[model samples]
Target chain A: MQYKDYYKILGVERGAGQDDIKKAYRRLARKYHPDVSKEPDAEEHFKEVGEAYEVLKDPEKRAAYDQLGSQWQTGEQFRPPPDWNAGYEYSGGFSGDDAAAYSDFFESLFGFAGRAKTGSTGAGFHAQGQDTHARILIDLEDAYRGATRSISLRHPQLDATGHVALRERQLNVNIPKGVYAGQHIRLKGQGESGMGDGQAGDLYLEIGFNPHSIYRVDGKDVYIDLPVTPWEAALGEQVTVPTPVGKVNMKIPPGSTQGKQMRLKGKGIPAKVAGDFYVVLQIAVPPADTDTARKAYETLKQAAGFNPRQHLEKQS
Target chain B: MKNHDSAPTLNGEVLEDYCLSLQQLCHGATAEPEFILQLVEYEVLVPQGGQEAEWRFRAEDLARLRRAQRLTRDFELDLSALALVMQLLDELMELRGSG
Candidate 1:
């Protein structure tokens, strides 16, 4: 196993005080926390920082690690000198959940020394299995009309010897109608493998819609910007608009202004829960370059007597 | 910190293995930092001085920078579009771990 230089990871001197170590950890953690950071390796960096703080933040662990000698190169072959931890008394051994997340190298040094504590249970008992998580992107139509999708997932399976092996399986998922983006679908027994005869953790599937050419989705509502001619907007017209389910006739209200939004009830993608569809009207002005078009515009301007910006009276 | 080779070993504790200076880490790893800077509103790289001015990078910084670069060059994403992708990636990872 490779050795990690926690000092280097945390960017601190070996003799750095606890407060210094903590301040560095807090600074780095905020910069790299997977949730808030946009750095590509934020997740890996977060893990490394967490691991570093895991050792250095604790006085006992830090001292024991310092005793290992600075000459031992990082990732160099390591064998803890016999009874290196002999006289060191570690108060409050590592909790069970944390021990499991620590590396084998860490576990080798600290695992055996800690007294495993399982509190307030039967003589011997365990609970709270690991949760399973997955992400799936479905088409907008799938949400509108619902779908039974065959999803293929590859997950790690640990062998009897405890080495992980990649295993693939196919599951048929029932996509409930009208599921919006960012929603979750949970399935039992779809997560990390269970431990010690315990029930498997729940699997959470985060919902995402594939980029659609015809639609833009916003939280239970769908918006499609449709282009209409000036004449079509001025004199109301019925046009065929594309909805998630199918193409339908939508009425453009008379004297509609440019950039006006029109709604089609119950025409959006339908699922178990349904959202409304909105058609944003974009007026397409006819080019006046042609003589016929220029004559038409001249006639209209003379007849209509319209002054679009007449309201803007500059005080200065 | 040196320009040792094009490929870095994926394992072990060598400087090349664990982390590298900014330039070495980003060498050919990304398209350019021009657009990525627009996304974060942060100037990603600054000169360290002399010959090393363009030669500094931390592993954490380089990894995400490279990923951002890939989303633009390899994935053909615009700045606004890349922001959306980055946002979704964060959300996706959270859902993955929590689930």
Candidate 2:
């Protein structure tokens, strides 16, 4: 296992006060919390921050971790010396239910015994297992046509001796058609197993769309920027617009300006109440690179006498 | 490790609008009924029916409820303040999506 420097992860000095450590944790947590943050790898960073705070916030754990010494660098191959935590006593069991979220180094030091004790030991105790949540990214095309997806989930299970181990399980799931972003697919009895005769919890898979090059989804509505020639926008034209289902010929209205949105009703995701597909017109101007092209542009400029900066001049 | 090729394809139901009961929502969110009730009192989550027993929640409500739980726990926010934050976050998401 690699040694994780909890102090360095939290961006505080090894000798920093508990109050200062807490302040740093709050600042980082606010910045990296996955729900609120837009940063890439926010979830990973948040988990690292959480694990660091878990150790440093508690005085006992902090003292025990400090004994590991500051000589060891972060990510260095490390093995805990026998009897490292001989004297210290942990006040409580592992704090969170998901012990698999923590790193191997942290688990090796303080995790095993605490987690083993958390498993239900009483003969008569029977309760439903906790439901688990996971987000899955699917293609927009998959929403149009239903598809099967293979997902790998890390499930924590207790052995016969009550030792918690993270077991990776692969499940093939049928994703229903018309599933949109923020929607959830509930797989019954796929979550944590219940104790004794109690029923297993359901697994809720939240659907998110992988970013597509040509499409942007807002709810069920899909938007695409279609490049149209200046003449095509000026004098209507029939253009083949690509949709999730297939390519369809769309009539571009005459006098269409740049950024003009044309709505195709019932053409978006195939929800019960179908959403509208919006085609935003982007007027593409041909470059006047050649002499003939330049001449044609010059003639049109002289003939039209059009100034696009009229609005700015009027405002000024 | 389980075999990937021979795994049975499990069919799942897509949770649609106003399909989840209060108990289902609570289980999905891993939150207490009291916490959900507090959320309702703060107007953070408004279900479909008048009575709590008859209430039906949307799939979106489950998502919102989870986010609410995380924000409240991390920031140690009160119900009223969390309600305000939730409203602002909803507006922010709307603006981002449209923009």
Task: Give the best candidate by TM-score.
Answer: 2
Task: Give all TM-scores, in the order shown.
Answer: 0.54, 0.95
Off by over 4 Å in 1: A1-16, A34-45, A60-135, A148-172, A191-198, A210-214, A284-307, A310-316, B1-99
Clash number for each model: 9, 0
The candidate that wins on lDDT is: 2
Highest DockQ scorer = 2
Model 2, A60-149: lDDT tens per residue? 999999999999999999999999999888876477556777888887888876777667568988889888888888899999998888
Each candidate's interface RMSD (Å, one decimal) is 21.2, 3.1
lDDT of 1 by residue, A99-130 (tens): 33455566556655553332223534555455
lDDT score at residue A125, model 1, on the 0-100 scale? 58
Error of 1 at B74 (Å): 34
DockQ each candidate and list the results. 0.02, 0.60
